[model samples]
Target chain A: TQLLEQSPQFLSIQEGENLTVYCNSSSVFSSLQWYRQEPGEGPVLLVTVVTGGEVKKLKRLTFQFGDARKDSSLHITAAQPGDTGLYLCAGAGSSYKLIFGSGTRLLVRP
Target chain B: SQTIHQWPATLVQPVGSPLSLECTVEGTSNPNLYWYRQAAGRGLQLLFYSVGIGQISSEVPQNLSASRPQDRQFILSSKKLLLSDSGFYLCASDPGGEKLFFGSGTQLSVL
Candidate 1:
């Protein structure tokens, strides 16, 4: 079974702080996706990185795929109170299944 | 674009009771449906997936069983509930095999 490991399982930061969450995997994936989920709701896709070393930016959030497609990272710049949520990384291989990371819980203080 | 609909936003059931969770998809035909369970503040564990009608794939063997009666409908069932079954259940659809569109999710508590 494929597994994705996430770092800094829980994060607490003040508004305007910058944070980076890492997702590492021993298995190579064809594509990687990042999602943010609010409490009591399912996760919403943030971005998908397909190419190695590719970086995609969505406002203050930036996502990067590893050079080997075995890892990924999500960087948030100047996080706001609204950014407080659970961030998840999911990687898809040749199969239709997506293996998910343990997730990062971000708490951005106002 | 595809949308997923999951029912029973929250449920509380006693042990040994029957369990049923329904999920349906809209705006897409022959989409891949998936059922996942998540622990508190953790990642999602894929329980079952269906690629077509009457085709169900089990990822983790547990007390859960899934069935796809229609092209857009998926159901998760358990004959006897367990306390360990309590968690947040999410229903998702993969329309393009790229990204997943998730429903609002259901919270199931087995006491």
Candidate 2:
């Protein structure tokens, strides 16, 4: 099985601070997706990176796919209280089934 | 637009009770269906998936089983519930590619 490990399982930061969440694996992936899930709701897709060494920006959030497609990272700048949620990175495996990372729980204090 | 629906937003059942959770997709045909479970503070685990009617694949062997009676409908069941079965269950569907649309989810609490 391909395993994706996320670092800093939990993070708490004041508003306006910057934070980064890392997802790493030994196995290469064809594509990687990032999702944000709030309480009482299913995860919502944030971004999908398909190319190696790719970088995409969504507002204050920046996502990067590793050059080898074995890792990904998410960086949030000037974090706000509304940014608090569980962030998960998933990769497409066999049959296009998603292999999810353990997740990173981030709390941005106002 | 396509949408997926899952019923029983919350359920509390005693151990050894029968379990049934239903999911259906609308506005699509022959879509791939998936069932996933998320334990508290953990990632989502793929439990089962189906590509067509009467075609089901199990990712892990446990107390649960899945069935696809119709092309758009999928069900997750267990003859007898176990305490370890308590968790959040999510149903998702994909048309023919990587993007997956998920349902609201069902929170099962087995006591």
Say which candidate scores most in TM-score.
1
User: Least accurate stretch of 10 residues (summed lDDT) in model 1 chain A?
Assistant: A91-100
TM-score, prediction 1: 0.99
Candidate 2, residue A26: how far the Cα is off, in Å: 0.4
Query: Across residues B2-99, which tens digit of lDDT does each residue of candidate 1 receive?
Result: 78899999999999999999999999998889999999999999999998999999998899899999999999999999999999999999988878
Please give each candidate's TM-score. 0.99, 0.98
- lDDT (10s digit) by residue, model 2, range A5-91: 998899999999999999999999999999998866678889999999999999999999999999999999999999999999999
Q: Score the docking of each candidate (DockQ).
A: 0.94, 0.72
- Candidate 1 regions exceeding 4 Å error are none
Q: Judged by lDDT, which candidate is best? A: 1
Clashing pairs in 1: none
DockQ of 2: 0.72
